[model samples]
Target: MGTIRKGANGGFSGKAGSVIGASWKSIDYIRGLSKKSNKPATEEQLIQQARFYTIAKFIMPIAPFVQVGFSQINANTMTPTNAALQANIKTAVVGTYPNFVLDYAKVQISQGSLQPGGTVKAEVATGMLMISWTNKAIAIQNGQLDDLVYILLYHPELDEFLTAPEPPTRGLGTVDIELPEHFLGGKGQLWLFFADRKNKRISRTNYLGELDLV
Candidate 1:
């Protein structure tokens, strides 16, 4: 048929695939017609169609809890509202937002290199997985922020890097980051890092927690 016209529901109704059986009556008749009219679809069209299906089915279902990050931050130089995070305050964050996003997903945070006397914590709805250390300041790479800390998420199934542990929306204390709650349950590990902003010294902490999202 001509483009099979978009559905009244404002979606793709294009019958791009082949029909089953055109000779059979009614149900089978439609299938037959589709099969007979099978035309080689473009790669772009297939990709678009696949993306449409993924959005309509998989991604959209998890949209509600997808934006999970920091909800609140309590510190001397930062609050849930500030963006520029200071290096000298103890910040406590809530897991409510992350709870929603990782209801069933597993994630990990990595701390590359950090400074001393700093601390990092990954607070899931269940508990806190933290890392800390004391000593001289460990400098991040030249271009990297002198004292940089955040979360890192790794996907074992995909054997690839998924997302960088970013700050929650609004910055510092409580920022917003998006995550999918549709996770692969079981024992997943997360890494947290804390960097110290100093010279001639090294400071850092490594914390790992099993992500139990059942």
Candidate 2:
């Protein structure tokens, strides 16, 4: 852009002839309009775009969880969602470009020093879903009793997700969550993890297995 002194016509604020003019910091400037490119994509570029499209389609819906999951990764240049996608695309995605498939079992939501509880169980009681782990006293002794539980249920077929409100602590051993009306006739997958009371620590996510929600 070239700076210009105000003329008899004053400074222009929009397009005039082949150039555009605007004022910044009380100084007037004029720059030529940029040209648009209509270049066509090459075969290789299309394939790469397909792979990115496949991963992005799945990741966008659960981006909120992805941010928390990849918060600890040491990548300063990219967002947490991008970090999670890069990490998962290598191992969790299967098949070729046009048919890329994401393996839910291989997906890692949260990674941290905290360890997961053993022998997790999922059961449907009336309209409530109950999740439990073994030996709550063990966690209390280790100073993780107050770690809050976070549960996520995803219905792949419906492309929907459900989360618990005001989850209980790890010391409770088992938590009962009310199932939504939409989840009554449908089935979905379950995953759970523990976040410390202060929310500074997160345990590796545990896949609590798929359930026939009722």
Candidate 3:
């Protein structure tokens, strides 16, 4: 038994004189065929139009929307936490693809001395890490004058952490990022993580930077 009712199964029914079965010799045949009269179309013209409609109805439902976040990480080290040691960017996105909305809220960092005499920067080039901010606010701040800013990198797969030589400065108050050759191919996200000695007090700040590989 057919699932469709008579009129519900719309389309020409192969009628002898209608568009579906009309002959070129008939009065209702297409005038120029290609550039014909609009009164009634020929069977060939009708069939061509029907095919187009069927195809259009079949392919418009599944597409993907993707978003990306940029940061630098080292490709040769892992943090003490197993994930890459991370310099606090405070704004990194995690997971394969993420959906994020910024919420203006207060952030705070407890623990750790914030001496005013040190600096720190985070960078990444390869591997991944977990980033979260559910209850705790973002920790880590900008560098102060005459502080040693340390750059740390992490390699997620091997679970290692490597520290770069400190860049000596009086008040270079900004995170300087560099991608070197050791990273598998010297490409990808480089995570810069760090700790310093100059800032032993709890009030000093460290800064981190973000960059995308070309």
Best by lDDT: 2
| CA-RMSD of model 2 | 7.8
Mind giving the per-residue lDDT tens digits that candidate 1 earns over 1-214?
A: 3233235532222233554323211222233232344778787676544434422332232222121111122323333122111211112221332121222122212112223233334444432223332223223322223343444444445432233454221114222233455544534445434333322222232434555533
If ranked by lDDT, best first, what sequence of candidates would result?
Answer: 2, 1, 3
TM-score winner, 1 or 3: 1
Candidate 3: C-alpha lDDT: 0.29
Mark the 10 consecutive residues where model 2 has the least summed lDDT: 134-143
lDDT of 3 by residue, 145-179 (tens): 44443333333343333333444433444443443
Across 1-214, the per-residue lDDT of candidate 2 in tens digits comes to 4334466567767777789988764666788899886998887887777777766777778887766766666545567788777877666677776777767777766667766666788888678988888555564435477777778888877888887788677778888888877778777788877777765677788887778877
Worst 10 residues of 3 by lDDT: 62-71
Write down the lDDT of every candidate, Cα atoms only.
0.32, 0.74, 0.29
CA displacement after TM-score superposition, residue 81 of candidate 1 (Å) = 36
Q: Estimate each model's TM-score.
A: 0.28, 0.72, 0.26
What alpha-carbon RMSD in Å does predicted model 1 have with respect to the real structure?
A: 18.7
Alpha carbon lDDT at 111, candidate 2: 68
